[model samples]
Target: MKRLRIISFVLSTIVFSTTLLTTVQAQGDKKSTAILDAMSNKYQKIKSFKAIFTYTPDGGKSLKGDATVKGTKFRLKMAGQEIFNDGKLMATYIKETNEVNLQDFDPSAGGDLDPTRIYSAYKKGFKYAFLQERKEGAQTFDVVELTSTGKNSQVDKVQIQVNKADNSINSWKIFQKNGQKVTYKVEQFQPDVAVADNFFTFNAKQFPGVEVVDLR
Candidate 1:
């Protein structure tokens, strides 16, 4: 009877220890979550901004673009050629042989891309951990990581440089577990610019003999 009591006490002690450890770990996770959410909140507050961007991959030709943002309007294009997508913008592009027209958009496309809205919906889509400080030309930054929440998402893990002076995202490096990787470097950020009302319009009459695909 004494042996039975001893065994029962031992089992109870083990269970109690496990429960305590589990509680501690859960608390730690919650605290970590709060830190990340704070950073994301700062990210979502910008109404408009601009930047000069360059992208270079391991073995591909570098591409450059000027990125302009006005409220939810966005325009990103490379030299005279580009692939542009905007949810709240209308822009025009005309070439000797072709022309493109755009209408305002809802900006959220099937959850792939949302300006700072990603954090509000999928805060855990990224893992937030700090890295060493880095300083560049007139820019000091802290690194935060956003990795695929899924095992098979083709997009790679992204490392973003948060500008120390403004708390804005400045640059990105990508690491693909299942695909190719790229690095996007934004050199300049302009937060002041008046975006015209017609900046988000698609006028086919403006460009005759041009293919007008409705992407709205």
Candidate 2:
């Protein structure tokens, strides 16, 4: 369940842009590439960001959590688990087991589950296209669809909704081959916030009776 949740979260993480649709082809798609590039550029400008998100997997109840990210470092907390990555090391704490798994931070590790790597991954193995425009209340959004180029990829497709006004990501949905659909809605987002380094590190002393397993 833990692994599935992490995978679903990773698959659902995406940002979109409002570039015009100029082509339908996914590979070397001019408009889609431009939109993705713009979104990536915007992300580079943010010093830090925090968001309250609700993750709902198909056939499962929704889970709420908050995440703070600074560059490649992030701290993600859900109901039973919390993951901390301080740009060099990563620790995953499981509340049920009262255990923490520590490992060296490999940018390539965790595949899509690694929050640090998702933005860049789109450029390589996927084809993207502008889907359509959508609106929710007063805010307008631009939707984009991403399809994996690899035939055997676990993710079938991903849809991202970007706020047209602020160029912020509103939400994303991931479709998996195994009939699981995971959606992540960004309820609140604050950019350029000051987050301390300590927030992304794990302190074992804080967890009494917790077993620390160092895999590094």
TM-score of each: 0.64, 0.84
Tens-digit lDDT track of model 1 for 128-216: 45655689888788776556665544444666676667655566666766466667776776655677645544455756788764535
User: Pairing residues by index, what is the TM-score of model 2?
Assistant: 0.84
| Model 2 RMSD vs true structure | 4.7
Clashing pairs in 1: 87-105, 89-200, 90-199, 90-200, 90-201
Per-residue lDDT tens digits for candidate 2, residues 49-81, read: 887889888789888888888877788877678
Best TM-score goes to which candidate?
2
What global local distance difference test value does model 2 have?
Answer: 0.71
Question: Least accurate stretch of 10 residues (summed lDDT) in model 2?
Answer: 14-23
After superposition, the stretches of candidate 2 with alpha carbons farther than 4 Å from their true spots are: 1-28
